[model samples]
Target: MVNLDSSIAFLIYITAVSSAAAGVTEACKSVIPFLATDYEARNDCWEDHNHAARLNHYKRFFNLLISVVAAGVIFGVMGLDPALILTGAEKVYVEDSWEVGTWLWGIVAVFGSPFFASLLKIVEGFKQSVNNNLPPNRPRQKVTGPRE
Candidate 1:
């Protein structure tokens, strides 16, 4: 059985880990789109106003890019199954000695809040863009004439 203090420490550790995970999630959400959009806008200016082409030209707009690159390292260092880590829903066959459930649960709480906040922001951004019919990070286009 783990000591009370140790259990508390472990819980804190898990919370910290989850916070780190959340940070990465937010960073990826923000960075990837910024990169892709910038790339797409530049492509749009260079080429004709081919919105179709710009839309079709997909880019790696997520942390999956980094995760894929570090697959080997992540598994090697953590001694975890790469497949499991990649999936994030992996269950290991380790025996549970102490009741450290609180830590894992706490991690979810600590991480989930910011994640949801960021997600809401992203959603709001999308909603605004769609509502106004304008590109993100740019002013909404003015209505020129009556809609058909």
Candidate 2:
């Protein structure tokens, strides 16, 4: 039911929204360690890092922070729920999505990508933990003195 031009515009809008999400996420990744008393990690993750990277990070960080704040306002003013965009897997009740409007889907796509990225990171950690706990396949070789 939505116009083609509006649908395209929504796509672009979400792209900006998602990147703004990424900026907030990145800012938190760097700042949270320091706030949580993880001094060693904080030092390694932020204090010991290259200066150029941190500068670039802050530039996007502040921009996206402001961007998403506005997006949240749009969400409130429009009275649309973005979470509906995430229900692609559900066959039932999804028909209502079309009636709900493209704006809802647009908002979700913009905000959802960051949450998706975070979810991936958490999954990666779980995988690494599982891999680390597996026992060695073979017995360790015995150490021997140097031959004459």
Candidate 3:
């Protein structure tokens, strides 16, 4: 019989690795310049806009991953069987329970949530940096006055 806690722990471990990978990928992507060839230092909304869009894209993905992993942790700690997750009127029990990896996985789950949250904060900070480095937008302002 498979142990519910162990299974959930394994799932949490998997989620942690995946989340970490996604975070690193996002960090790398954030470093690439949108205007690689531009030397004139012109202020273009398109470039800033594109960078913002990409940052937002990774942000959403990372947030979703964290949410899923957090859900896995919740289920695991509650002692709910993964097998019972699908069936409405079914229950599963385990006797032998847990192998060598279960404790390690549980430990990862306990730490992974905060780690992922910190990663999310780093990404947000990178996004803010991009925003700050972007040139300010200046357009023509309307003027109304009586003829002298």
Candidate 4:
């Protein structure tokens, strides 16, 4: 089994869960007609600014709700323990009947999905930077004769 206590492993696990929640939100948008509407009105005709604004607000709320529900299902019903490590602190796992941390993490995961890619990019860049800054190893010299 994978060790969730490790930083890298936890990062991968959270990212996967967040991406899955995002996918679920997208799927919900496709299946729900109201959630899929892009125009100001359902008929795809231009409507009053206020009406369009209201629709947009409602759509955003529903999208967030769907994302949260998806995350909850992933973490709760799926029996996946929600865990995270803050800074250099010890690992934190949320395991309880109520699963408050699970829901909280679910919300964070759903909202943070968009930024996860960027975060991974940043991490990769940092690793590359560190690797580049390290001194290169000296090539071994050929010893044609006995060492001095």
Tell me the TM-score of each prediction against the true structure: 0.28, 0.30, 0.31, 0.66
Better of 1 and 3 by TM-score: 3
Candidate 3 residue lDDT tens string, 43-89: 56788767766766666655454544444444344444433432322
* Model 4 spans with C-alpha error above 4 angstroms: 1-5, 41-47, 82-98, 125-148
Worst 10 residues of 2 by lDDT: 85-94
Per-residue alpha-carbon lDDT of model 1 for 24-106, expressed as tens digits?
55566676564335333445464644653555453332443333323323223334331232234335222431224423343
lDDT of 3: 0.48
Evaluation by TM-score, superior candidate among 3 and 4 = 4
* CA displacement after TM-score superposition, residue 77 of candidate 4 (Å): 3.5
Model 4, residue 83: what's the lDDT? 49
RMSD of 4: 8.2
User: Cα deviation in Å at residue 30, candidate 2?
Assistant: 1.3
User: Cα lDDT of model 1 overall?
Assistant: 0.42
Q: Would you list the C-alpha lDDT of every candidate in the order shown?
A: 0.42, 0.49, 0.48, 0.69
Q: Between 1 and 2, whose lDDT is larger?
A: 2
Regions of candidate 1 where Cα sits further than 4 Å from its true position: 34-148
- In angstroms, the error of model 4 at 94 is 6.0
